[model samples]
Target: MPKHISLISLLVVCSLWNMPQAVHAQALIPHTLQLDAENLERQGLQLAQEAAQLGQFQQFDLALPRARLASQLAPNNDRVWFLLGGLHLQAQDVDAAMAALEKANSLNPENPDIFFALGSANFQQQKYQAAADHYKQGLKLKPDYREGLFDLGNAYYMLGRLPEAIAQYNKSFSQDQKFWPAINNIGLIKYEQGDIESAMKQWRTSVEIDKQAAEPLLALAVAMYNQGDRQQALSMGEAAIRIDQRYANLDFLKENLWGERLLSDTKIFLELPRIQAALQQSDN
Candidate 1:
């Protein structure tokens, strides 16, 4: 799972909300009590930083507990809540992720990243409409956010709004031509609409942009095999599987939003003796 949310700076900035009311009046309160509060907040920030480092290494199991504790100690800090939400999302706990993300949004409603994270959580839960809505809200704040546009495209695709999906994908690609996933997904939509030639073109462009992208490469291979280009299809299929063997599985393809037509063709392609040999070779 991709870590959708990022840890913000740990250097605590004093904001008007948390600033002491009166410098003179603060002398009336015990110095030790203020020091303890400061110490606890500092410790919470340190723990949050540790959790973020673990998350970067994809150690979600270790990260989640620390993030949870950090959120408890730094209850007023939106960044702590955001990190907690991201860890839960990586762990596939959609409900927990949503709850933490909503809390983060409440604390800092102006932060577009929090809304984008909420969109991702909604996406995981299959609430495509809500996901799209959240993505739109985020985009309004930061119009050129590449990932947010791609995610909105996915949400639109899931909702059967192909044109809108393509528009969002194009927007994302415009932001960065090297972003192959958006192009790959556009190929998916084209293939589903029976535009094999256009789909192949998009997939080819994706492969040209990022040769390591197995999804578009496998889709192209499957299409080539269906069109009677056996030799090239087998070679391309082998190369794609070498990059990522998971693409050989139809279930994995489905998870990536491969349409029924493409999946049917890929199923047949996967059963070919040469492809089967490739899969076995890859396992070793």
Candidate 2:
């Protein structure tokens, strides 16, 4: 029989394993514009800063008005356009965000960050092909741009090009090893490829990196359960619930664990002792 671990231990381990990345990326964004025309630019810049603060606090409704005013005040400023685009995105106004981001990209074509943001907006709108194109363009402008590479990986994943997605994710992870999303995505691809043990290892690594991240924890639990580790699975599942009880598809996971018992009885039958021997050999 497998070891019987408590749900609490599982939760604690999972939580402790997954940690969030630092806010370095957010710091890279320009909070103020410095145009030669000092007064008008400063006024617009101040409004843009206020809008950014609002957006940061998830006050999208409040942010949009200020962002629009700033854009109106500094119509030619790429930063203003970018802020407006971000506000529109927060409001879930995809069309407006796209228009504003396009203008921003046009104004600052060399700025890979703007292109990455535009690609993200496109991805959110289900424009995977266009998102991929924009991400590729952004990468060309700024090689080793981890965000652009990650978004490109997601675009490829959405398009069902798992191998390409995996490749892009690998590239992104190489640049920023602590990026949890890329690690989780790679585990997902591995799981889909029927490499259960490898997938489990990757998911475990993700959880080790950031236990608070619900996605990888849930995925790891599912993988462990599928491999006939009921107690471990239950623990992981419970940990996921603890992290975010409102996480999407929680019901589905619960149903599988309690109602279906789909994971508990997955057969581990082998045809020959040599096959088992080979498996043990590979483990070694």
Candidate 3:
């Protein structure tokens, strides 16, 4: 799955009130005009900061207008355009997001985060190839960016390029051993490839890394159930559901990248009387 949109902080907030005026005047007209433009830019930065702060609080409705105004006021600042793009993404306006992000990329092609954002936009549109290409471009600029690597892996998985997906997942995991999502996704790919035992091992490792991770826990439960370890699987599945009930939904599992084979097994496991009862109990 793609990571949530993170608020960008490329520009620092500036206030005209805190700026020191020139003690000795140069060419008065041009200098005064330049100061006005500078003040507008500073105000734009301030607005952008406010939008980002609101976004951190999940106030996208309020953030969007401020981000839009920020871009209008700071048309030359890539940071403002990037912020606007992020807000558009939050609003689920993928086309608008792409437009703003492309503007930002045009303004500052060296910034990898814009490419990452573009990759996310494409991923949401189900344009897997485009998403992977954008991620590759961003990774070229910042090869060790763990989240970018993970997202690229997801795109590759969606495209059915399993080997490339696994490579990206491994790269992401190498960046931080504690990132269990990468491990969990490896399990997903393994299960899809009919290597049930390998898939179970990967899920086990993911659970070991983060015991509270519901996805891997439930996946392990399903694998164990498929292997005829019904009693223990039921116990584990119950625990996983209690930790997070969303995993009980097959659609949610599919959204999380569970392939058809694993999903078929998961559906059967979820339909078991014990698991169904557990789901009911969790709902209570």
Tell me the lDDT of model 3 at 235. 95
Candidate 1 displacement at residue 188 in angstroms: 0.4
Residue 197 error, candidate 2, Å: 1.8
Tally clashing residue pairs in candidate 2.
Answer: 7
lDDT of 1 at 207: 97
Pairs in steric clash, model 1: none
Better of 1 and 2 by lDDT: 1
lDDT of 2 by residue, 113-216 (tens): 78888888888878889999989989999989888898899889889888898899899989987998887778776766677677778778888888798777
Winner on TM-score between 2 and 3 is 3
As a TM-score, model 3 comes out at: 0.87
Residue pairs clashing in model 2 are 17-207, 17-211, 18-210, 18-211, 19-209, 19-210, 19-211
What are the lDDT figures for the candidates, one per model? 0.90, 0.72, 0.89
Provide backbone clash counts, one per model. 0, 7, 0
Taking all chains together, each candidate's TM-score versus the true structure is 0.89, 0.73, 0.87
Model 3 lDDT tens row, 1-284: 01111111111112223435533232344555566668777888999999999998989999998988888778999999999999899889999999999999999999999999999999999999999999999999999999999999999999988999999999999999999999899999999889999999999999999999999999999999989998999999999999999999989998898899988998999999998999998888
Q: What TM-score quantifies how close candidate 1 is to the native fold?
A: 0.89
Q: Which stretches of candidate 3 lie over 4 Å from their true place?
A: 1-32
Give the alpha carbon lDDT tens digit for every residue of 9-124 in model 1. Answer: 11122322365565633453455355656766788899999999999999998999899989877889999999999999988999999999999999999999999999999999
RMSD of each: 8.5, 21.5, 9.0
Model 1: weakest 10-residue lDDT segment is: 1-10
